[model samples]
Target: MHQVASQLPAEAVASQTRPLLVLENLGKRFGSLQALQDVSLDFRVGEVQCLLGENGAGKSTLCNLIFGVYRPDDGLMRFAGREWVPAGPAEALDSGIAMVHQHFSLVPRMTVVENLMLGQSRGLLQHRAFAAKIRSIAESFGFSLDPEAVVGELSVGERQRAEIVKCLMREPRLLVLDEPTAVLPPDEIGSLLDICRRVADSGRAVILVTHKLAEIAKVADRVAVLRGGRVVAKAEMATADMGALVRAMVGREVKSLDVALSESGAASAPPVSAGDAPRPRALVCDGITVKDRHDAVRLDNFTLEIRAGEIVGLAGVEGNGQSELGMVLAGLQRPAAGRFFIGETELTEAGPAAVTAAGGGIVPEDRHAVACVTAMSVAENMYLNKLDRFTRFGLLRRNALNQAARGLMQEFDVRAAGADVAFSGLSGGNQQKAVLARELTLDPLVALVAAQPTRGLDINAVEAVYRQIRAAARRGVGVLLISSELDELIAVADRIVVLYRGRLVGERPAEPGERAAIGALMSGHGL
Candidate 1:
């Protein structure tokens, strides 16, 4: 591993309290991209320090460097008055530092206790004692997880609890959490924040990486905003607010969802009439019931409709049948009992190809897995759904494909080195943009189903996506937008529908001050 002596200036090191962890002038490079440059920070014991940034602003890179996932190219690190350079994650853990990544690392086939004890120098049957100890610690943090339950059988929230339990079992001095609350419900988010607070209060330092500005107030003692591989701003939570953070991160002002929506006047539009001749039903589902591969009910009698020239937002917590509903609408999965319609034509069991032929577009939740091919070029992936249009006589036309891809890339502002670059080389926001450019550019589109459309995007990219979705509605294409963010639904949707446990429980016009009511319904309370 790369190692260097202390290059941090004495004044910078002396300006803070005795720090448990210190990083000075840290730098990392991935091929041509400098993921981190001259980054410096100090972490004190018994405090929560939040790392705030856009998707590609190098927050994860810093955490990975500290945790021994990547060796820094420059700078030095000191921990507890000693130079600290861990060769790997095992050494980092041995030095009392543990990490809970966004994606959990537990073995799915193992039980909770078994997974936790995998790396420990203990026999297989010795997990019972460990399980009892973990159960007590988990209860103290108010997380209810069965020690004997298989990891695969737990819910997302439960799995997070198990991950945290695994971390605490090691009794680490410094804990790092990356976007821990991204998939959690509002109630679970409160619990997770409470857990973080307790961990910090017990003399352990916590580093939280997140994009949600609102979460900073709940647990952050200090906040650092990163932009363009630099720490643009840092402040104590007592004096910092959302506006200041947004300005520092993006170098400009940004309006909140409510304020932006109010200025746009989208919520004041008149409701669509069912009998309108010009705007007919573009997508319709009648009493759809679906089950997953494990024979669990995902959608129970779910029904909805979106007419042309309208944007309907589906709001719900993650894993509450949103994925199943999107799959059903995209014709990727066959509903057990339901009749789907695309502009008055019933399509009960049509596959993705048939749906695409009928003017349907899809932006899947897991974009890399379901939407794009990583090994393919950007130009090839752009025309994935409509290959025949660019092909003739069983021969490929590279020039035509590249030309069309370049035009759409320019139109959508897809930042890439070139059309022939690998699709995996693009950033997360640019990948989403490429998907949007391909779908929205399709002619005669009847319905567009977008799942988690703005996930992992920066604020600017999010604004671009909202504009494109609205523009598609104005172009006489029905749009079904599924998102976990209630504020996003309130901002861009003409009408919002709440889904709970595979059922549509509430529907309301996307008006101001409706978030509270919608949030209640999402948690199984009455509207």
Candidate 2:
């Protein structure tokens, strides 16, 4: 029997051990774009190396190259003192390298155990043995997962856990995780960080690719900042503050939105509106209840009213019915009970088209799934929902569409070459801006939803989005903002509501330093 030590004491080892993985002069190019250029870094064993960058800043590209999704055009990867070039994912796995992609790659129909064992060596195909191994590994990592559960039936956090287990099952010497906590709730995120620490404690190296600076502060041992496809900064986590890190990533001075708000005189604004401020009720949900396929209530007894000229923020951990609630509000799905009213029109059963036609706009959480068609041109995507306005009878007026697209591009300050460019060619921040421009141009009475709105965006772009949302609210458009980032919610929302296990657990007027209270509520504690 293998008897591994349960814990390693502080005095047990030397600090000068060689790194487990090293990249020297890594360069990768795709057509005209140089995704990664002459990047170099070393990942030490039993350490968490945090990689931070803005969208399209070559963080993902570096990960893809390291994991063998794309080979580096000019680079040398050395693992355990041996030169290595992984030809593909399979080869990478065989060479003790494993990567969990930012986007899920599991087949929904497959069982958890099946997905876990999918790419295992042929010798481990025996069902009983494979299941046993998966369970054992899951237990070791403090992950609770049902081997027989289908991937489609699992929550987002569970699915992520399964991915981690799959990587662990290979006994990888170096593990690469991309945006692993993007879908997790705050409490669950702590658990994930614990898992990462435990994995490293087991004498393996971990590379965490994320944009969240707070997570880096909590868990990273060392950090590497990438900007414009190059490693701009590398330093010990203890020696870096959030301000310093932000400056390193963006190459500019950093200031919190709160500070900016105070400087702009928004801090003196009244917490709750009073007097004759139009008091227009834009959105109302009357005792709404939504059930999933299993007849379980995903949203229960949910009653809320969002007034025009206000932003209502929903704060919760993932899988607390935030997605379902957002979908229902956006009219993408019907509520099982009660009704949603836009002005006086009941929209409980209204389809997406009807809701959109009623001056309701949506920026869905899953961008690729609901927001834009990646393969289509920016102009075509811009006119997707408002095509009829630009079209004359049955034929599309291409010139009008292009004209509108160009106008929106200039208005939103979307940093793309032209409207004719494909949506996929733009960065994530730019794509989100495009979607926002399209949705807001309709002059909607109620802008239904936005999830993680500022995620993957640089400071300047995030500020632009904030300004747009604030302007919309000022124009008497009710806005619903859903995000796990408490700082964001507090920055923009007039009111904040916490969701816990499919129920509205708490509500508070937005105030400074109220995040801790809201976070407690989100974790199922009374505030």
Candidate 3:
């Protein structure tokens, strides 16, 4: 990819690491779109090589080519110093290459064990024999998962772990992880990076595709950045900092959170002072309790309230019940004991439609799977949650549906060719924007529950999303932002609450120099 002329710099040439995989002038084309161009690189054994790029910058295309998801138009690949060619994913896996895509590939309706054994040539007896090996590999990577757990019943983070475990079961010499930490909390992210180091230290190569610039310094030994389907810069991590990586990917300098989101800016909140009249409560929860598929308590007597125009942030070490709480608010999970209300209207057992009718909205963590229908057009998905409005008796209103979609796309800055484009065709940022436009445009919306809304987004996309959330709060819509980024919580929220073992352990007002205290509370400190 920058800072070099025709070959690698002198410093990189000085390294003695052996290349496990080598690509020479790799190129791939999809119709008129040249998704990848002359992407020549080497992945070395016993090292973590990070691939940094903006969404749609050909990172996925290159990874797909490497893992046999797509055949390269022209190139030469040498794995272990031999010509490498694979017909399909199974061939790649059999040849010691495994990939965990950003979007999961597990069958949600089946248990983890069943999904893992779906395409195997072995019978049930042989498959059951590998269950112990799978569990052992999972535990070795610090992943705790039940082989018999239904994929649909697992949380987003749990599902991610299952997908990773599936790949590790193959014991590949080269492991590719695409945006693995996008849905993980901060602590879990650290652990995942550590596991990557372990993978490399054990004589394997890890190709990490991620949007986070900070992580490269933590785990990567070499870095390559992609821009507009071409490699712009490639260097040892010791020579590249976060700022350099950002400049390489975007070709511009980006501002930090402190400099960009000032106390008096649009992302700011007014001080909590004595008011003239009491503001109306938009969202309230009383003694909510939830359990997992195995009947383990997830949320225990979680009581909270958010007044109109206020933003409350939910912070926790992941799996302490943040996902469960968000589900209860979204009407997807019925709490064991609780009464959730929107403006004094209790909706304890209401479905998603009823909750929407009661002035509530949610941006789920897994947007591709749970939030939007991937096969439908953008116009259809924008109104899929409220199709009744676009239908008259048994007749469909196509014109009206397309018109509404066009309006929302323009108003919310959704980058797409047209309303008829497939929802899955848009980039990750545009997809999230469309989901936001659909959920936040309810006529009488008073509350919004957004879970990890900025995860996996580039810097510009993150800024756009932060502005939208703050704008919603300014419009008197009570907002509950559940995220694992402490700096993000402090930046966008007015108050931050900690959840530990499915209960509120403590809370602190969003203030200067409070990260350490909040982190302590997350670890179950100070009672």
Candidate 4:
């Protein structure tokens, strides 16, 4: 990886005649929270500028300001040497600025071409012309997008390509991407970086917003460290090493994974042994096939056995049947065909309650969307799945629930203001920890699914999660981990299964440095 300082000539040394965009004394406040405080930065055409910060450090707020989601409370934005204040998304796009949010924006039922042309303002309807434009753009960007393919049918990588295509169709001079690689496998991350570079080399500017320092080191030309809503360090990517960037972003020197692993005795340690032989099959699926609301098969011939004392990883690019499999296993959806068993009890048509009663615990993929109710208090949300444990005869038992929530919160190390606080008030990492706490505390015979369990978490929190997973396995709990992050999967899983196009295509032992090969298999490049 290039050091940050060597990457830039010097701040005193100017490379270009003019910057493409400049934010002067940018500031935004939400109630008492100073989300962005006097943040100033510049992006030049044909260069990739990476923004790094922890969650809630005001990175999203800054992007929201630039995208016109909320007008800056203070500061001036100049683009292409013109002062600009975009009214909204349309105005922002009109001003040669486009942003792809962390969350997907494409309509699930719409085709790629339809989505690309959703908000276009052509005076006359030109479906054919727009489709042709999409095809041309996709080809130029080395993207194989089926313009007629439904958005819901595309893999996460393909959906991301569609988003990029949507922005490219606008021909924006500056493209902003927020956490673009968060849902991508390690090997696919390189491809995304290549696409970003290609986009920038095409004479446009790219602003990458991410918290992963390794990714910044790989792709950023210029690195800007954001801390508490302020740019603490700005330097060339080639000159700034990960150490320097870590110091700038977190205001402290951070240890690398190797160092951390050694210090924690994670490396050079004997493999933790399972307590005993687990029940023959805690959860079993035989020839299972699942379909979506539209009756499209999202999972085909998926057969798996989860035994106690094992962590089974479902590795794939997002949208490659992982989400649907998780839903089906969790009993949120019933498979169209197949037999599902929890300890020999048939559950093919069972609902979530029945699944839970059958000793299944689910940590859903989308924490906000499906796992927890944002409006509910943390205590309430924590006990949502195990309400019967805290209540009797359909009457509420507030004391028991609160006690359970408090104990679990302490055990899980979930950082929250208070137990009564709304779940939405906590950070993303804390929310995930809360979800884990609830599901794992139930001590189910089988853990249905957990996706991106350590995403957006700090180093310490990640360590905690890893320890939790190990402990669960030691207790003879069957864990089904579904994630795009290959490193995490390899670290926690005993075996890895690759899914491609809604089918189980490959299997391998989880090993370090084998990510590229596994990713290739997941993309259907290997037999």
Candidate 5:
């Protein structure tokens, strides 16, 4: 058990409305990397404070320090006008601080209520009473989660909601939410922002860690931007504005996505003509069916096609068979019925190796679990899909692998200490870049299934990924882009298709002002 001081220092009890939390010259280091340095910030009650940063800009480090997941190597943190030294998350929670991490920490095999009950009550817990309370919190937060639903059976978005509700059940004075909107639909995003504001209005504080600039103006009273292990900028939402935040985040003026896309004028493959040959279909699926653990039909006879040199967007609310569809396409999960093809060749009941062996690439949604081996070296993970090229007699050629990995890193701008650095050592953005570099460069790679490709990425990183996907399309690869962000689908995909309950319901052109219609189709309104 960890301990915290119960009383505030007499010298610091001067003001009644003091900051709820305060950090002064705090620092943390992970080996050679100074993850955070000389950071000073304040969190006041009755305000939604936003922490803005690039993927590797030490935002997570700061949060961990606050929640007692990690101790500061230097400086101090004062909570409620006291020198707070919470030795662990339990102590932090005891002091009225709760956290919703980016990655879910629920027990998958347990029911939602069961998962939340763990470490909550010291003695015997009345399941019914706890479930009723959970339901109340869920309703207040605009979330609908079945208390008895098993965590593993729920979709990614549903799991996220469960994780959030778990923290909210504590009713803490300070709440930390890390990229909570990454898996939520646009319609739900407004509701979530409202929740943040409501929490603040109740004389509590919310520290929202996010990269989306639009969100700052809506819910945030104050904003802080971090870069290179330091706070580069801080301002009230009304003062500095979005552009200033972006400039501070990336250290330069970045062109907005719309401006960049318009200037590029990226076009799809030319329409087939009477005298011209039909565009080649790079990937095709038909009559695909899938069932969940509870024998529930997730996808029913779902089918789609992607022609060479085209990017097709799959749009829907989260948990609507989007992740499952991507898994099926990547040959990760076997479909209950039907088959798919890559470039005219039938791919019946496949695995990752077989798909990649026959012209397929995949960017999985859960990068840590599916797309990467974090413990391995970055260079080794880069060649994960194509080991034969760097191996002879079942052994890797170290020199050649390093040389090639160096080239790919430079080409993709994968920042790291060295090619030998552990994949986990890199930031989230760099990890995604490394994965893309590996998958996109596969020879004869005609099709790609990118699931939630830019989720949780900063604006600059998102722009970079969009350009890379477009570049792959230009190289005659067909791409099925699965995304929850409607704007992303519209900007990146040439044709947008809707998915509802594992079925394709409708489609629309990737044109401006088409989100509402597509959103409706995704919600199954026209079914």
Candidate 6:
């Protein structure tokens, strides 16, 4: 446990009304692991309370206890000026508490309206009015949704919108959101924060659990830092800075994204001299065009070139051809026309195996589906694309493979039960790290394509991924980083390009001041 400074700021002092929910000396354990201990906090009405910490820091564990998903071994909790104990989520919901999980709990086969009316006592026709009300609320928060739309057909952001609507339908007095921005785009994060602010202003309590430090400054009225399953620090948002929050969470000084830019002197791309020759090409996409299963044009004559020792970032909103482009680069999807090359070797119409054999690496957006086999052991997953190296006389060298897996796990700092453990048992961040370790460690790597590489990662894990990408670029590897985070693109990419409706809308040097322009381009506005 760390020493928490017990000084209240002006805002915290003035807003010290009766707390909506209070927890005192809360403690919980799972077998030998103490998930939470001595966690005490007060969540006040009409304010946003943020639980800030790295992954597995007891943030979600505390939320589960409040939502009745788990029973705290030792604690005292009071709600509405009375002792409160709930048996399950239904009891908690009926008591004016609702939790929106990181992974939504809506039934995919049902319509949005049907999903919202699942446990309501009201009739089905009454849900029509509820649907109208939800639409109005979503509009106010700049969310566009269709109540009649099937949940399975909704995009990631739209599904989150439906999840919020479901929570609001219950009129929850205390609303808890876990990692709300994990699947949202960079631009949509502001809108989500605004929604939280609006909910708090409506005289309701909001508890936001996230590891992104930037989010704390954006919406948190009060911030609680959890570390090693304990409340290590607590301070009013007005009094806490990023540096303070980082120290409390990780117990060390870590360079934030902005600070890294300042130290690198690469805030903006440098100008090329007239005499400078064109850089040697590492990856080239020549007039490529693609379509989806529905015959919707996904890539419209997309063309781009990346040079060795350079990083080119692809930025766009979801469903704006980024996914299709990444698939084409990884040789998973056959482009309708045009072709791509790896360092002068043409790889048009090639499959994923040939592309990997040609020294190309792919870190997909969805690691589970494309990168690793969840049912396989960690060692087997590491050699998924390169199993030939460990095979002899039609048999796999199990001992040699396990030895290599151990070495790679140690090098990647992968925290798992063991190399023999199934990949599915690992956390999301660890799974992504495994993919990176496998892809980046390839010999004679020519080009690397990473899509949303840091999605759902904690601060420490994000830093590690960034360092690995930077190291790859330093080794003269051409890198294509496709992400929704503009801040991430500007931090490391040499150039940033925007895709809109399957077309290249704009291209610019990665610069700090160009974010607004890039955002406009991403939304299919001005070039």
| Per-model TM values vs. the true structure | 0.83, 0.86, 0.89, 0.81, 0.92, 0.81
**Model 2: residues with Cα > 4 Å off, grouped in runs:** 1-16, 109-111, 124-150, 153-155, 261-274, 387-430, 456-461
Model 1 residue 295 distance off true place after TM-score fit, in angstroms: 4.6
RMSD of each candidate?
A: 6.0, 4.1, 4.9, 5.3, 4.5, 5.9
Q: Rank the candidates by lDDT, best first.
A: 5, 3, 6, 1, 2, 4
Predicted candidate 2 versus true structure: per-residue lDDT over 272-335, tens digit per residue: 5466555667788898888877798888978888876778889987777887777887788888
Off by over 4 Å in 3: 1-18, 24-34, 73-85, 122-129, 386-418
Q: Pick the candidate with the highest TM-score.
A: 5
Stretches > 4 Å off in candidate 4: 1-16, 251-276, 291-298, 343-345, 367-369, 372-438, 443-445, 454-464, 513-526
Q: After superposition, how far is residue 502 of candidate 6 from its true place, in Å?
A: 2.5
lDDT of 6: 0.81
Candidate 1 lDDT, 171-242, residue by residue in tens: 888998877776565666777888787676666688998777777888898999998788999999889877
Alpha-carbon lDDT, every model: 0.80, 0.78, 0.82, 0.76, 0.84, 0.81
Candidate scoring better on TM-score of 2 and 5: 5
Q: Which candidate is the best by lDDT?
A: 5
lDDT of 4 by residue, 13-96 (tens): 243335888999999876666768889999986679998876556776777778888899899999888886888877888888
Candidate 1: regions farther than 4 A off: 1-16, 103-121, 125-168, 258-270, 273-275, 292-296, 345-347, 373-383, 386-438, 442-444
Error at 360, model 1, angstroms: 3.0
Model 6: per-residue lDDT, tens digit, 159-238?
Answer: 77788777877778899998878777776788889878767766678999887778878889999999888998898888
Clashes found in each candidate (C-alpha, N, C closer than 3 A): 0, 0, 5, 10, 0, 0
lDDT of 2 at 109: 91
**Model 5: per-residue Cα lDDT over 1-527, one tens digit each:** 00111133333232325699999999988777788999999998777899999888998889989999999999999998799889999999999999988777888889999999998667789999999988988788676889999987777788888888888888888999988888777777888888888777666779999888788889898999999889999998877768878898998888867567556665445445699776789999988888987788898898888889889999988888877777888878888888899998777687888898888999987787689899999999998876678888999897898889999998877877778889987767788888988988999889988888888888877877788888888888899998888888887888899998788999899877887799889888866
Model 4 score (lDDT)? 0.76
The candidate with the higher lDDT, 1 or 3, is: 3
